[model samples]
Target: MSSSLRVSPFSHAEEIDFIQLVKITLQRKKLVAAITVSAGLIAVACAFLITPTYEVSSVLRPAAINELDALNRSEVYKLPPGEALTKVGASLESYETRLGFFRANPGFFKEFEAPGRTLEQSFEEFNRNSISLILPDPRKADSLSAYIKLEMTYPKGVDGVSILNGLVNYAIDTEREQIASDMRVIIKNRLTEIAGKLDAARANYEVDKEAKIASLSELDNLRRAQLQDERKALRAQLKTLRTDRVAQLDEAIGIAKSLGIRKPSTPSLLGDSERSPSNSVMRTEINNQQIPLYFMGVEALEAERNALMKRKSDDFTEGRIAQIAKELQLLEANREIEVLKSREKEDLFLAGVQPLRAEEARLRNLSIDMAGVKLVTIDRPAQEPLTPFKPKRLLVVVIGIILGFIVGCALAFIWAFIRNRQSFYRTLPISSSGAGATSLDGEPPRIS
Candidate 1:
């Protein structure tokens, strides 16, 4: 018994025949051509109808060293050209900065305003899509290759070039203002610190001066007390000496009257026994010693006693009394303490204050006009582009034609498949065993 191989028609359906596909496409040439032409015409119309978007780009480089020299020379705050460039770039990329710029110049972005969109929505769209910052890739860039590129896109009728240039300038100005404000704060803080130090120094100086004055006053008081004591003692001594001289002269007068002697008498004149050589030697020896007051005559003793009694002020008798009075007078004033108290400019005497004052003055007098300061160098300014950046007419039409051709080919194949399956069903015969339908020639139907 020979077994017949049964083949299913749908088995070949998964396989593609290019010739058959071509025939099917040719048969539907009108439909394909219609679709292709319609898509190309639509694309052309869209290309013309869509708004043209223009791109404006600008490059930012580090400022020249000379441009930043003034800032660095401030000594209070310093910023390098590269850092300034970085700051400006950061400002350009900042959303707040962009929004600020947008709000500041509403007329520039007036085209972005629409009926349904709020200003915030407009800005969001602008910030997300319209602005782009291109920085050098860190992995491929060197230190000296640092730069930033700013690109802006806008539709026709918008001044993209002016907007780009204005944005760059605004970012630079914002960064410059920030730098200047930071420097001013630093200077103000330093000035405040200097003022505090000066106040402290003055306080300390005042304390020291007061201490010195107190010490000098104490010392002068002690000196004055000593001088007063010495003066009192000298005056007492003079008074006692005068009283003793008066007593001695009175005693001498009594002795002279009792001895019946009227003149200053020596031992030899007193008696004949004292006239010997040995007595004369004794007299000479007695003269060498302090002589007795009775040896003076009554008249001379009385006159001396009278002068002693008449003496009122004995200051001339001792030179030390005059010196003590002079010293006491000097100590009463304390010239050194007086000088310290009368000083008008105490800052000059404080240590380390001259340099601080000079610095404070310099900082106070510091005036930096950031208006002329350049934060970044514009390598290339934004120029008006002659051509639009988007909606390329030829490319769009070409793509549309290609897509339409593909779609037309797909539809042609689908219609061909439907027609072939319907014809196969119409020609199919019923099987005797009631299993399935088969072709009239006892062969499986094939898909055309």
Candidate 2:
């Protein structure tokens, strides 16, 4: 026979120690309550200490007929509407632009002061706390749009409306002055370019006319010289021919005298000499043969000489040359007239530009008289706000109460965990058995 091992299912079913945990938490209730109440009260006090902020906002839109549009319409060139205003808005939005404005107006910094801090740091804080820009559409976000809203918040120490209005005026004037200056510069450059072109055209026209007249005059002089030379050569050849003919006639007369044939009607036909015509017949033949063809006799020569004289006189006459000169003069006059007309056109353009320049000058002083840019106020700053901007007292109190209860519960649970751990160690049992018996960590003996 052998002893068998017996196991009970109820041995593993220990009861939970919730009652002990409750007892430990109850023991530390006073400590948890003190911490919770102190935290809640401190949070409430801090909330009250924060200064309440007040807000004032204003809206602006482009004028129906702004100065920029009017200027563009009147001038030969056009500038986009609201361009200058948009640029001004951007500048006003810039950190540097604001800083510069603050620097210029040192009094503006009095309302915003952070002791022991540099001006720049104070200015940055002031901008963060006091200014905000509201864009209607995120997609079309630009200073160029007229639908931008500006909001300013300042402490009760300063007048928010006065400050905002003053800044708005400053922005408008600065932008107008800048645009006017640019317009003046553009007009000046255009005028300079036009004047240069006109002067160059006039110079070229004058030079061309003078060159053509000089060329034509030189050609006429060359033709006259050629005709004079030819006339001189013809007169010399006619004189030489007449002298040769006279010498031949005299030789024939001497031969007749030598033969002792005075007043002979004709030469006898000698058997030893060839027969020839008489001196009178030869003289008559000379007069009849080639003299008329070459010299045209004395009367004809005088008539030819007279004709040559007429030709020479006609050559010096200024009829055709005068006509050409008159034509050149007319052309030069027409060119001058054209130049004058072109100058008139330029002057007209400049005339249009002049008024614009004067308008620019006027705008430099930031006058509203000349149209360029205009700002219309949509909403003015509120004189008094209905409620404080932030730090709701009731909300702060509620948050503090809820946070205190949670913190109290957490402290109570932590106390329960520490107390239960100590009690559990105290209540643990120790076992004693025979040498051969196995401890709880060892294997149990087997039975068959």
Candidate 3:
């Protein structure tokens, strides 16, 4: 026979092989159909087993205009004192101080740390003892801490998300109000300090007034007494001089009278150009009147001298007293002015300070605001399911069917390769039986 298209020594009849292939399909039809049906049914089951989730959302706005203005005035403008409400720095500083203490002295951790025998134990203890939050807790899941990891997933298409967002917004607003509260305290403190200083200044002025007035009064009294004494002394001296002058004049008049030879002629009351006394008695009486005139002249001179002393003393006292009065008036005026200034600063201007009063005011305001927050609610979110979301059997089966088909094809190729190996002998360097040597087909030649 020709080399081309000739039958091989091991060749099988083509029709018979065709018949055998048909027989195989007919026999395995049930198995293939069963596998395909199982795969399809499993996929349908998997599709039905999935879980659905919902989402929520919300929005936030910045602080109100009036609130921002109040804060700006207190923190930036440095305006005079006013009644703008604000927050205190007490809590902020306290928080910082706590953080500092923890950072610098980690030993403080010893007392506060979770009690446990090992690091892992301690971590668990801390989670159980110290940690509290609104999210999924790890300790709640037994195997999650060891083998599985979890995360927080934000869901979509839900109302409760809005509630959470609103809560966050509210927390931010609270912080803003707290800032203002601190500003209020700072300003209030400044106002208080200024007020105290003003009060002290006023007190000093009052004390000064009392001392100055007391001294001035004593000095005035002393001056007045001295003037009186000087006037009395001058008057006494004048009176004594007048008496002596009168006596001396009387003696001279007597001597004159004793020497009289005849009575002096006297003018009558109607015509007083000349007068004479006809008897010794009338002449002596007229001469004695001249002694009274001499006494009058002496008394008048002494009175004039006393008046000058009194005038001089009064002039000195008035000048000194006036100076003291001027100084006192100036101090009083200054005190009044300072009081007015203090009032204006406290009543009209704003000082950014943190005060207890500011905190109280802020709390009251928050009370009003929190009432509004309560109205906002989370209506929709990822909810629990009527069906579980695990074990996707249908998809798993379809994948298994495809994998089985691929494996079947590989088995068919492997069978063909084995048959080819047996036919081809010397081309491939393989032995039927040897240590560390093997035939291409996974069969040992019978130990012939």
**Tens-digit lDDT track for model 1 on 1-105?**
323445554654666688877988999999899888888888888889999998989999998999988878878777888888889999999998898889999
Lowest-scoring 10 consecutive residues by lDDT in candidate 2? 284-293
- Superposed model 3: Cα runs more than 4 Å off: 1-67, 70-160, 250-254, 257-448
Model 2, runs deviating above 4 Å: 1-50, 65-67, 82-85, 138-146, 223-372, 375-387, 391-448
Clash pairs, model 2 backbone: 67-371, 67-372, 67-373, 68-372, 68-373
User: What's the distance in Å from true for residue 106, model 1?
Assistant: 0.5
Order the candidate numbers by TM-score, best to worst: 1, 2, 3
Candidate 1, residue 387: Cα displacement in angstroms equals 3.2
Question: Per-residue lDDT of 28-119 in model 2, one digit per residue for the tens?
Answer: 77866787687779778866776766677766665455445556664533545455445656655778767776677767668686689888
Better of 1 and 2 by TM-score: 1
Per-candidate RMSD, Å: 5.8, 13.2, 14.6
User: Model 3: per-residue lDDT, tens digit, 1-448?
Assistant: 2121322323442433656544544555565556556655655656555443322222222223443344343342332112111111121123333243334444423433454455445334433433222322456765331111111122222233333333333433454455446555665675576556556655665566566656666665666566556555655665566556545645544543454312232223213323543334322224433332222333343444445434423323244445544554544334444444455334222233235346535434432232222211122323333332234445566676775554444445455445554654323343234432334444333221
Cα deviation at 24, candidate 2, in Å, is 20
For each candidate, give its TM-score against the true structure.
0.82, 0.50, 0.39
The per-residue C-alpha lDDT of model 1 at residue 270 equals 72
Per-model C-alpha lDDT, please?
A: 0.85, 0.56, 0.40
